[model samples]
Target: MTTFEILNGAGADGDQLAGSLNDALCTAAPMVERISGMPLPSHVTVRLLDVAASQALSVVHLGLVYGMAAERLDTEEAFDLAGKLAATAGSRFRMFERITWPLQLGKILYGPTGPELVVVPAAHRAARTSTRQQTVVMGHELTHLAQLELWPDMLTAGPRLRIKAKLTGQPTKSLPVIAPLFEGHAQFVHRDLAAELCGVRARRRLPGEAAPTLRYRATDWLGAVPPLSMVRAIYDRGEKFVSAVMDAGGRSLVHGLFTDEGSLPLLPELLKPELWLARHHPVPAHNAHDQ
Candidate 1:
């Protein structure tokens, strides 16, 4: 079950928009589970935030990442030191990018019960985006919730990697692979959910339109000795590689990784998933028990 809290900013249309969001999420939530082959929280509280709350949450997220709040501090001196360094990096160096992140559509909220999902419906209204678009945003955040539930460490990969860079004085070679895997899987899942929402909304087959293809260079994604600094730019690369992996081995490859970490792609295998596929699913077969 999902309960919603609207924290201002819908104006008179608040009730109508809230109704649309509830319906959309009810339909969309299961799609996330089906695609990722993972379970979502039994109950998730969804918050619809206005700009002020959205921006405030962004700062909180950063604070949590960096251990700016004392209770979140770890025992490890290295972890805590790196977190302090991360906080400094964000506040001092990445101000503009930091400013932009809070303006996003939705995010996974960390709460006492579990990870909740939050959206800025007013962001949708201000841009005149459709319910389907807003639903897709919900799906994207929903994927993150699945990630948080199933592989919480994956969500922490970014901050940890930055800390590694701070420690080693160089970016790890795996930067290209890890960052993309984190985001790409969610991007692919949410878009698939978007298409389903569209079909459900229309109650008919989607109209044939030539969807524009997105092209990305392996170099751009793979990067030439990726610097820790390119963290923002390389995340977009994940969807293509994830799509390719799904094409090669299907959702079984995704499902396998959760239970059998051995199947998780080697850092080098991330960009070339076939290498991982050839190793893990070369037989190209799975039974009911596989999932």
Candidate 2:
């Protein structure tokens, strides 16, 4: 079992809000381990940021560190970029506070010590969601923390996909190859954790709801790189696909099958999980349903 610490800076409701999230993530941690068969880090931290600090952190910390190259920006680039984002970030801050919903609620950041999970207490200071919704969101984020533990060296689709788009000269055209699985894996574990905790599965989409996708329209000086926000949107796909894969393969998807550096799915396979399923989990037809 894994234990966690909660750091609350979300204002007056911060303690109450952080208490709920701490309870949710702490309760959900073992369930994530059970579903994935991967032991999460022995300890983790979840920080609840108020509206203002969340925006600043998003502008500076996320802006500087996330890029295609394994190496981060040099000092000159970091300072210059930081300044530009800070200047324009006023507009973006309003957007995050008013518009963005759950993505603004929870995310994981890595640093010298280890992975850190930070989240907003509410959509804004004035609005706080129900306890259950907070648990669902925390479960999703906790799964991400588990993913980080399982695949310590793995980078998500955003950076590598961006660099590939640049090289191929097809930013808008290329499909994000790794996103479905990488995100799907987290979503599957998260949703399953939700099911276990709540006794209801949110697997089906309501009528007319669009299937989630990673839309890739190029922008900024770097045409290939997706803006910070869209990075979160892309991972919302593959919950169903992951469920199908796990169903066909076994009770729980093999965390290693996807996490293993040597045997990870290729580009086409990620786009169509069926291809990945067939390649990695070659179940006999008669036994397919049973698995």
Candidate 3:
């Protein structure tokens, strides 16, 4: 099946993905800790799970993705396509190594909270990690770890998205830009650090293979390429767009889009220029994953 179909939920569970998550964590835990600059609370913990555990989490995340797609494409064929996309996403669950920062997406916790990072295996495999790629992911996740370290304070910046969804009977996706401010900032930090630490040269590449958008690759602030979504049209070009933004402002201002929680819509405006003003300033340089 195509990548989109796979995201809808295709493959069987309890297979290589689970084992890999476990293995990658075992091999990576040390480096993750060393490179991650975020402070770890005394009560914080890290875990490596097999397929059963990963599948459980995958079911929840996949369900969310499918439901979102369903709203946009509610016909039988649409639902079928959605399901396939979920399945594809599920099947490839084996191809990622994710870092689950919070128990729920939008919720924040105080110290003595649950494990801060759930590093998945699938991502490790997809990167075909050499020392370089491993460092990149580690840097990416480490940036996330930094965010998690300060998570409690960060939540105040935006409304709790999941809670809003439940109260309004709206899908989390309905918000148009549902990710927490901290999440957006962390994502940008992760991308930036990963490229520097791992020598990724993200400006030259696109975010993913899905679209035909181009992004700018300037100071490589946050190391992010542009949206490969129908947004950018191509990966390389998307990188340039992003690079120009970095050049105009600084990375932190761009990241503040999520953290600032201003009158703007984060996701949809990802391609717009009004927000580019934030980038007009410069983002202070940070070490790889300066948690």
**In every candidate, how many clashes are there?**
0, 0, 55
Residues 124-149, candidate 1, lDDT per residue (tens digit)? 45444455666676777777777667
Candidate 3, residue 159: Cα displacement in angstroms equals 8.8
Candidate 1 ranges beyond 4 A from true positions? 1-16, 68-76, 92-103, 111-113, 168-170, 199-236, 257-268, 275-291
Instruction: Let me know the TM-score candidate 1 reaches against the reference structure.
Output: 0.69
Scored by Cα lDDT, where does model 2 land? 0.59
Which portions of model 2 show Cα errors greater than 4 Å? Answer: 72-98, 101-103, 124-128, 164-176, 203-236, 251-253, 261-271, 283-291
Determine which window of 10 residues in candidate 1 has minimal summed lDDT: 211-220
TM-score of each: 0.69, 0.68, 0.42
Residue-level error in angstroms, candidate 2, position 86: 13
lDDT of 2 by residue, 189-254 (tens): 777766875666653333443432221111111222456545544465466556666777664455
CA lDDT of every candidate: 0.60, 0.59, 0.39
For candidate 2, the TM-score is: 0.68
Best-first order by TM-score: 1, 2, 3
- Give per-model CA RMSD: 7.8, 8.5, 13.8
